[model samples]
Target chain A: MGNQRDSIGDSSAHNIYLTNGASEGVRQVLNMAIRSKEDGIMVPIPQYPLYSALITLQGGTMVPYYLDEPKNWGLDIKDLEYRVKKAKDEGLNVRSMVVINPGNPTGQVLTEQNIREIILCYENSILIMADEVYKNVYSEGSQFLSFRKVLNGMGAPYKDNELISFHSISKGLMGECGLRGGYMETHNIDPFVEEMFYKLKSIELCSNTIGQLGTLLMINPPKRGVEADEVVDLYEKEQGEIYGGLKERAKMLTATFNKMERTSCSEIQGAMYGFPRIHLTQSAIKAAKEQGVQPDFFYCMQMVNETGIMTVPGSGFGQRDGEFHYRITNLVSPTSEMRATLDRLEAFNSEFYAKYSQ
Target chain B: MGNQRDSIGDSSAHNIYLTNGASEGVRQVLNMAIRSKEDGIMVPIPQYPLYSALITLQGGTMVPYYLDEPKNWGLDIKDLEYRVKKAKDEGLNVRSMVVINPGNPTGQVLTEQNIREIILCYENSILIMADEVYKNVYSEGSQFLSFRKVLNGMGAPYKDNELISFHSISKGLMGECGLRGGYMETHNIDPFVEEMFYKLKSIELCSNTIGQLGTLLMINPPKRGVEADEVVDLYEKEQGEIYGGLKERAKMLTATFNKMERTSCSEIQGAMYGFPRIHLTQSAIKAAKEQGVQPDFFYCMQMVNETGIMTVPGSGFGQRDGEFHYRITNLVSPTSEMRATLDRLEAFNSEFYAKYSQ
Candidate 1:
């Protein structure tokens, strides 16, 4: 599946482990790395809950670094360095750093330079967990750059930095989330740790056969000359349509969110979500506190009740203290359907603001 | 899926949780119930390794109660009670007991009397985990009796005993192991504990959609009038043939092992395996000790090397110290093929005895 032109160089079969889903792979890595509360995992604030949840489940310390939402949800090397240093100061052994490129919720694709800087910052101090499941789902100008590719491009010591990159058939064009097909590729990971991973995986016997087969087809789709020309053509056409539709939906969702009052959304550069920061009035916050829930959760619940538009409250995924945000997917199909949903959301936001402005 | 005619009573939908496989359900329960080393889980010796492995992973104390080999691998209530008492005396909380019925590897079906005695022994002190994946795979004159049924029959106090009964499409006549489909039914479990289970399961989203659907079909197969009669007839015929073939193989395997020199196998009343105790000579034991491996492992390895037939060492499943045993599955298809394999086993066993007897 690697392409030299894209700088995603070769990966050996021995280093790859097929999992039920990217979540399973993520869980295994967290479980392997975290031994106690002393072991810390560096995660992004307003992150996918899987990382935080798994860390808590494994009894590990979460050393969170806030993503720069003002900078279109970009990674700040200084913020990461600060978090790691602070965690270390607290007597935590920060074992791993999780980087969700083409970020979940905050869907900004990382630049190659950003990736290189993060690699240099962590070096060999922590294992890099690269969650690049949305590698194929990028906005027009924001191309996906894999951590393995960036690390490989760097020479000697940097190249030897341990990294585990995850990909999923559930994301990208396949959208086979229900099938639970994904894989993790280990790069420069210690041989002993790799063996431990294999041992842990073998405890479950194997991933479901259907999911494994789906992963195979995803990574190695029909090639032009290797298969019937018509079959290859149909495959390419369908894949292109899916990608194009996703790109269009992402753009429309971002535009719609930006247009809403008291709400600001970073560009949906990649992945399926658009996490918009909502500016709730003091009364709304007070009302939410009275109800014993986060403001974002209250807003989301209200939206759901009023318009039947479900959203994930940003509190579920750890956000900065007192900040209100909600994650909405661009996956509502038929383009027109998504447009209608956005229209309802905009109307709801206006009514909410008017009701609570006093 | 419950049939009152066979003493398998009705189950509510709210109580059932679909899993990737019976293994996953077992892992979840172990994870939920085991909080610390002071929490003890009672597991049968000569048990399926899944229980032992999960208990160890969860860092819980494994209080083993050995099943009687001489009495056809029957559960002894006194043995269980003794183990529980010993664990409790050691300052451990005896949390749960695992009963693999229509036993794995041991292949014995529990009598209704035995099941009732077990329920009375533990009562409200420990939760019962019934691994009933092999409930349908029984020999002639042997019946699969669920612990749920026996407990319900015992009236109020026994019916209120907490139990989690697991069933799998991977076992029984389905044998869809690779598809990874199973479900666990919670009976009289604490509402709060059940809620915690739901929360734990939600971390992985849901089991694979395909596996869940497979489990649905397994529990609710087409009825004669509900679907085409031909389809129902075909399903019944195939299921019957598979069951009949397994029963025949189980009987044949038991007979062959009993006839072999210095080996004794109990009746294969149910389940898919034959656990035969191999009488390894002193010289053989000495040789195995020198090689730093269990005697049964050494014997199984030699058998594999000579005959290309693989069997799991009894040591893997836990057994009495100094006892040599191995678990061989009666899953080889076609009566003639199973017969040939048995002949090979007999020949290899004789040769092994002759070489090591001195």
Candidate 2:
């Protein structure tokens, strides 16, 4: 672990603490990193709620940048720069940016160029805490690259950017969310900052030892000489199939949703969620207001109540002003169940439009 | 859970969120609860360090009441009242208090009367996050009493106090710390506060499902209907043996330490640690300074480096001025290894004194 971290150009990489899950990791690290004065974190507007909630708990401000929904959930360098500049100008002590690769809700993988641009544009020496736990689950023929790899490929200004990469055993091959296992790998970090991380983690003592064991398993899976080639091949093959299924299901769902009137969704190239925009009618919005619920939330709750399908409302993840959306995870029974869920969503959308939207 | 909290006449009891371990539970709830402006939490000095670290993270203040080390690590009610009033008079918003029964570091179990006094003093308004994870390890003839039980039994101001009881699967019969399983039971909390807790927890979605399953196992253990008597007897017998062994070791270690000059340690009535006062000689302190470490840290690190005995420093947990201490968990080894530990500690103390005093 020490030598591996040293090789990564992070003198304090060895000091990066582990947690039961990325949630706990975020809570601890952010809690340590954020200050009420002169410390804040930037996150994508349609990002994981963990960043916002954890940041809130730490009494730190959250600076949000929009992921262009119309542009396939792509990162716009201009939007990023604008948000960072705005936050700084407004006296929000921004310090770090949380990037979700194979993004949550809006599941678009960043292009290598996008990654390089992010490094070059964010000039204030701000740290990047990359959530790359979904790195292993990319669709075949689509090359998934680590931020570290891209940075190393860039070889200069980008390579020197401070970054902390998070990985998990829950997402890719095992889908072992119940295991509550994850790790943070720091690259090109300062020594004193690393010591602070250790000091902060020491308060919580250590993460679940079992979860750490799972991390060990993920990092050092059965290799050649240690395990049979046939067994390893079977494991890899199973994961590949799972990845293929996820990709196919995501594409099919997005395409199907887009076919519906006033409903649209971005292509889910990576993560397990399909965040679809559902245009609510004026009547529907009025009806939802009467019931004291956001239109999307009302739609989601109604859909769940009627069809027994659960999907999070867009308000759960921040959204653009007046733009309604809901996030549905792709894990809904991959075979017949997913089709049923898609069908239910379509039917609900139509019914909702007829009754309220009209 | 909702009905149970309502029935208890306080919503906080029902608002208890479950986590993979008490550490995570405490971190989350405390972080959430202490977010208000003027929120200050009173924690016992020589605390489990998690308190200070968490309060610091949340930008909350920690008002500490020193444990009466001379009185078997007893809670000084006068000191507690003084601190509480001082904070209040100073306009610091004192929100809650954390009491670790079967105290960490120091293993003194609070007497029923002592608990009653604490409850009366708190006046039921202050939220109490009672950590009773070590309840099962009380000394022989000293039954562990829940704060809820004492509150109900006495029918005083404490019956109205917002109490959250925390328990873990790590320290009791299973000793499965690696599993990271625990639950918090809340009593006498506000409904709105409970809802807030729910909303906060939803931000993390849920604790590990398997850990929740383990909690279910903990709360609802197996019962053999036909072989009830045998099963009961078997359980009782195993518990008795473990409890008996722990008490025996506690007695042995306490007696041995008490006899040593410049060293004094209280009897461990409960809990897994022995927070012993290491009477360091001037020379020993000088030597530790030369090594560039806190005396206690230097001592503990030396113990770990030379003897492979891992122990935490008192500085990690807060301590009185100039009082150097180290936490020694009773997990050194079984009976034989326990003896070896005592021997090593004794020899180390003698050598340390002779070298320093000389």
Candidate 3:
């Protein structure tokens, strides 16, 4: 717990809530922030469907801001500002904005400058929800700078800006998804609101004790002096191996997608996914329209049928109109198996393009 | 899974949903059934607060029907009829009704006749939500007849009545509260509505796999033919001891409450509670009002401070006006320890009553 607090600039125990997963924490925040249909939550266009789905479920207006895909899926603070302004102009209260640091589908780690700009864009007008579940899963050159760290470092009024940063055992080196362990740390949230959050959480009794234990283990892993040298060494070695493997797979997946015909992928800086943009021919789009499906969905269906590689269509996650993509996880194990799967996907894409182009 | 299906009258796997616990299942059902404030749910008075709390959370009107305290907390179909009629008359769509079999707090197990009468009362007009988590916990001579079983037994319209029955590993013989494992079985529900339920469930991904495993183990425990005779015997022995202990404690607590001055408790036929009504004097009520708390709460607080025994005031759970009651779990271990606790409670009650009377 002390290690957890230290990691996040001395977050008080009262401000941290252990959840079933980061998903539950996000839901709680959404529930709290969204009082009516006019309450808006700013979401990334190529976002994880969870955000859109939960926003819809909570009856909140989704003010979408598109990621600049050409700039390696980076946030454009101007786009966020415009969206919030438009939402406000349309008489919607921009209650909160979600930032998936080390992004979900479009996996680009937000730089410190990008994060600072985002905080500046929103200020204290809206709560910032930083989904930092993949905080530890960054690429070699990329770094995962937490919103809390950046906000705290920027003294006075900015530091007091309300933020809720989430982390999970399901991601990072643990990948303990089935264990359903995660937590949210609130920064500068009102005491009354925190009490309400606690009351809402208490309604569900508590997250499973096993999940809580998993969260504890994840946050406070074996350290140098706290354990036997051998134990600490083994823990560090295993963690490093997992992190390294994930990074390699992410890079390999991105490279494979980029190599495919009529497809391009931005660098997967962090997170578990490689959301590749697919360039479908007019004929292919027409065929998908005839079949009453989005082109990306049709393409994904073909890939699943032909190569047995499952991926979610970009339409499931909102995208720019007429632009198509598919979200594929880089979580396939054993480098050789992953390579074979990627190769199969490449071959299938080529044939599908050839057939559709004709 | 097969055993689970067999236990609940050949329920289809598609109709069964494993949840974090029966609480989660109940919440899901409430969410599904409650479309708006106009949608009313019939709840028992002195009910499990989960139902009332969730109903309010879902923004559904709670149509309460009182259990007959003089008749050992038995359901009065006439009372339910009156409540539903009253709600309908007031422009509420009485969509569903909740029945906690082997009741919570009240500890009443509805008889086959009561179940059949209840079905007749509602028929196809309303969905029946049977909270049967305590289906396996019942005192001798008081059999637990599931609403599903009784409904199925009555031919034609009654058999086709929409029903959702819940069970949990946290209750009964297992008492694995922290495991957070349970399930809900839907009966005669529209496939489309079921599909909607599935979609809602998918939004949360899934309940933790460990909870699901616990559910499977709970529903499909080792039987005589499935396991070695000795293993089966040992399991049965342990299970019997636990169930016997619960039953004995329930009886002891009920009897002790009955023996107390200015107190009364119905027979503890099932479940794990003895909600005893306390006869507070006018002076005590005045004192409670001055302190700005429920009379029962004031008394319970005094009991906690004096005897270190904790109990929930009946005000938290809706009770009849002018009545003061407190819910106490008959889960205190070892017969002697339970006896000692009862003795302390008796002493505290006598002193408090004497002081208040004066």
State which candidate has the highest TM-score.
3
Candidate number achieving the greatest lDDT relative to the actual structure: 1
> How well docked is model 3, in DockQ terms?
0.71
Question: Candidate 2, residues A1-358: lDDT per residue as tens digits?
Answer: 3223223443343645677777777776686668785577989979888898788766788888999887778799998998888988888878898989878888788887788888889666788888887753444435566777777667566678888877776884647877778877777778788777777777776677767778777766666677999989987787677777776788777888889878888777777878989888898888889999898998889889888888899998999999999988777656467887788878877887777757
Candidate number with greatest DockQ: 1
lDDT at position A103, candidate 2: 88
| Superior candidate under TM-score, 1 versus 2 | 1
Per-model TM-score on C-alpha atoms? 0.96, 0.88, 0.96
On the 0 to 100 scale, the lDDT of residue A27 in model 2 is 71
TM match of model 2 to true structure: 0.88
User: CA lDDT of B298 in candidate 2?
Assistant: 80
Clashing pairs in 1: none
lDDT of 3 by residue, B258-338 (tens): 888999999888888888999899999999999999999999999999999999999998789999899998778877898
Choose 1 or 2, whichever is better by DockQ. Answer: 1
Could you tell me how far off, in angstroms, the CA of residue B302 lies in candidate 1 after the best superposition?
Answer: 2.0
lDDT of 1 by residue, A155-270 (tens): 88998999998887788474789888888888888889889888777787778889898888877788888999999999989988777777788999888888888898889999
* lDDT, residue A349, candidate 2: 72
